[model samples]
Target: MAKASYLAGVALALAAGSALAADLPSRKAPPPAFVPPPPAFSWTGLYGGVNIGYGFGASSSIRGGELLTQVPGAGPFAGAVDVAAGAWNMPTNLNGVLGGGQIGYNYQFSPWLVVGVEADIQAADLRTSQAAGVSYISPVTGAGVTGYANANQYVDWFGTVRGRLGLTLPSWPNLMIFGTGGFAYGSVESAHRYTRFDGSAPLFATQASATTTSTNTGWTAGGGVEWTPMAFPAWSLKVEYLYTDLGSINQVGTGFYSAGAFGGPATMLVTGNQANFRWHTVRAGVNWHFNPFGSSAPVLAKY
Candidate 1:
C-alpha cells in the first residue's frame, strides 16, 4: 500500500509539471498589424497648356445724321446721310476658333481640395460684318439719290484673371472637378464709310471713314474636369467652359470728305456710337503636376 501511494503522488506531480509546460507563454509573436502610411499631397507646380475652342458674341446698332444742301451742278440737293455711322453691326454672334496658353500656381489646402490663381490671354480673328444700303433725296433738286455704307467691327483680343477651386476624388490616380470665377478685360473696334448724291445725279462723290474703340472690365465664371492617368509621370488634361459679362461701351467715331458743291472742301462729321456684348468660350488643355513632398520611390502611386 505504501509503494502504491508513493507512486500515485509522483504521477500527480509529473502531470502538474507537464500542464505548466504546455501553458508557458507562446514563443511565436502575434503578426504585426498592418500600418498604412499617410496620404500624399498633389498639385503643386507650374503648369501650362494649349486650349482650342469656339466663341459666340454680338454688337449693338449705331445711329447717324442727315444733311440737305443745293450746290452748282447738283440741283435741289436733298439727302439724309449718316454723317457718321462707323461699323454698324460688327462681328456679333459669330463663331470662331481660339488657341492660347495659361500659367498658374496651385496650393494644396486639404487632402481633397486645392485652390489656385491663374492668368491667361488669347488672340483670335473672330469678327462679324453687317451693312445697310443708304440713299438720299434732294427736296431742293426734286430728285432721288443713292449711296453705300458699311459697319464692320470686331472683338478679337481678351484676357482673364481667375481663382480656381478643385476637388480631389478618392478613386485611384488623381482626378478632380473644378470651378473658377474672376475678372476679365477686353476691347472692340469698327470701320465706317459714307457717300453723297445731288438728286441721284451723283454730284459730289466722297468717302469718309471712322472707328470706335473702348476698354471694359467685367466678371467671368467657369467649371471643368481634370484627369491624371499616370501618377509618377504627373501628366493631366482638362475641359472647361467660361461666360464673360463685359458690360457696355459707347464707340464714338468721325470722318471727313466732300459731298455738296456748296461745301468748298471736304466736311468732317463725328459719330456717337455704342455696343453691348457677351462672350462664351469652351476650351481644353493639358497640365504637368509635380509632387514636391512624396515617397522616395515614385512620388505618386499608380494602381
Candidate 2:
C-alpha cells in the first residue's frame, strides 16, 4: 500500500510539471528581415519641361542717316543743299509675355555639385514703336522745311543652347542654385517711315521695312533656383532669369521723292541703318525627370 501511495505522488508531480510548462509563454520566430525604401530624390537624370513668363528690358536704337535736296534756281544757280544729317535718335523699350519648352540632362558629381546641358525655345510678343520730327529752313530755297519719322521694332521668337553649373546645400540636397551661359539665336523685324514738307506742300516721303527670318546668333547668361520634393522624386520646380544679346541688324529700303525746285519726280536709295537687340526674361517652370540609369534603393530610419 505504501509503494502504491509513492507511485501516485510521483504521477501528481509529473502532471504539475507538465502544467507549468504549458502555462509559460512560448518563443516566436524573429520578424521577417526589415527592408529599407528607395532614395527620396536624385538629380542624375533626363528632364523635359514647359515654362511661361514675362519679358522686359528689350531695347533698340536707330544709328545713322541723312536727307538732302536739290533746288534748280534757288541755290546760287542750282546745286544740292544739305538739309537733314546724322541719325534720328529713337530709343525703344519692348515688354511682353513669353512661353516655351526645354529639354536637358543633368549629372550629379557630388552631394553639392552638378553639371548639365539644356536647350530651349520661346515664342514672344515683344514690339515697340516711336515717332519723331524735326523742322528747319531749307538751305537752298530758304523755304520752311518740316520732317517726321516713325519707327517700329519687334522680336518674334528666340532660342538658347546652354551649359549649367550648380551647387546644393548639404542640409537640403533637393534644392539647388545654378548659373547658366551659352549660345543664343533669334528672328527680328523692323520698319520706318519719313515724310518731309516745304511751306505746307508735300516735298518727299520714304518708307522702309525689313523682316529677318534668318537666325541671328549671339550669347546668353543667367541664374536660377530649383527644388525637388521627397513626395515626388521624379519632378522639380524652378524659377530663372536670363539676358540675351542678338547683336546688330541692318535694314535697307527705297525712298520716293517729289522734285522740289528741280523737276518732276525721283527715286532714291536709303541705306546705313542698324538696330541693336538685347532682351531680359524671367520665367517659372516644372520639370519631369526620367531615370536612364538603374534605380538605387535607400535606407530607412525610424523617427
Candidate 3:
C-alpha cells in the first residue's frame, strides 16, 4: 500500500508537469507566409505628345451683316436710292491640315483606372471664295447699270480643355484605352466686295472689302488607345488617335464700300448677312509617360 501511494504521487506530479508544458508559449508562429503586395499600377504624373492628322472642314455661311447694293445707272438717284441687303448667304467648305502638341496630368484611382485633364491647340488653313453682281436703277434718270465684285476668306485654328477617363489593360504590356470630352472655343475670318456703275457711264469704279471674325463655344468628345512601345527605366512612348466636333458658329457681314486693295478698309455699311458653320477634327500623336507610382518601370511593347 505504501509503494502504491508512492507511484500514484509520482504519476500525479508527472501529469501536472505535462499540463504546464502544454500551456507554455507555442513556437513563435512561423512568420506569416511571406506575401508580396499586389503590383502597383502606373498612372500618376505628367505627359506630353505631338499629333498630326488630316483635317476636313465644312463650308461656313455668312450671317448678321448688311450687304450694300449701289445702282450706277441711277446717277444722282444712285446715291439716294441705292438699295442695301444683309448677307444673303455666306460661303462654306474650308479644308486644311491640323498639327499641334498636347500636355496633361493624371491621377490613378486603382490599378486599372485613371482620370486626367488635358489641353491641345491646332492651326488650320481652310478657306472659301465667292462673287456676285447687282444692277442699280435711277428714279430721275431712268437709267441702270451693273456693279460686280468677289470675296475670299478662311476658318482655321482651335484650342480646347477636356477631361479624360482611362482603363489600363494588364494583359497588354503598358497599354491603356481612354475616352475624353470637353469644351472648345475658336473663330473664322472672311471677306467680300462689290462695285457700282453710273447710268450709261462708268461712274468712279467703286470697290469694297470687309472681313468678319466669328467666335463660338462648343463640345468635343473622342476616344483612343495609347501604347508604351519603348518603356525603360520609368519612361515610355505612346501613340494615340482622337476625334472631336466643335459645333457651329454664326457669321456676319458688316458692310460694303470702295476699297483700293485686298486688305484695305472699304466703305462702311451698318448691317450685314448672317450664316453658320460646323467643324470636325481627327489626330494621331506620340506621348511620353513616367510611372512614379509603380515599383517597376514600364516595358515598351507595341500592339
Maximum-TM-score candidate: 2
Question: Relative to the true structure, how large is the alpha-carbon lDDT of every model?
Answer: 0.62, 0.74, 0.59
**Order of models, best TM-score first:** 2, 1, 3
Clashes of 2: 0
Residue-level error in angstroms, candidate 3, position 149:
5.3
Give a tens-digit lDDT track for model 2, residues 168-231: 9778988999999999998877676666654534454444444444468899999999998877
lDDT of 1: 0.62
Q: What residue pairs are clashing in model 2?
A: none
Total clashing pairs in model 3: 31
Query: Tens-digit lDDT track for model 3 on 1-303?
Result: 999999999999999999999999988756676555644447678887778776554555544333334434432334333344442454665566777788888777766887899898877665666665556553434556455545565658777789999898666636778898888766666566555544443344554555667766676777777665433424444444444444443333344444221122234342443334455566677766555454344454554
Model 1 per-residue lDDT tens digits across residues 133-231 = 555444434455455556565677777899999988656336778899899987766655545443433465655556667667888999998777654
Off by over 4 Å in 2: 1-28, 69-83, 138-142, 199-214, 261-271, 292-303
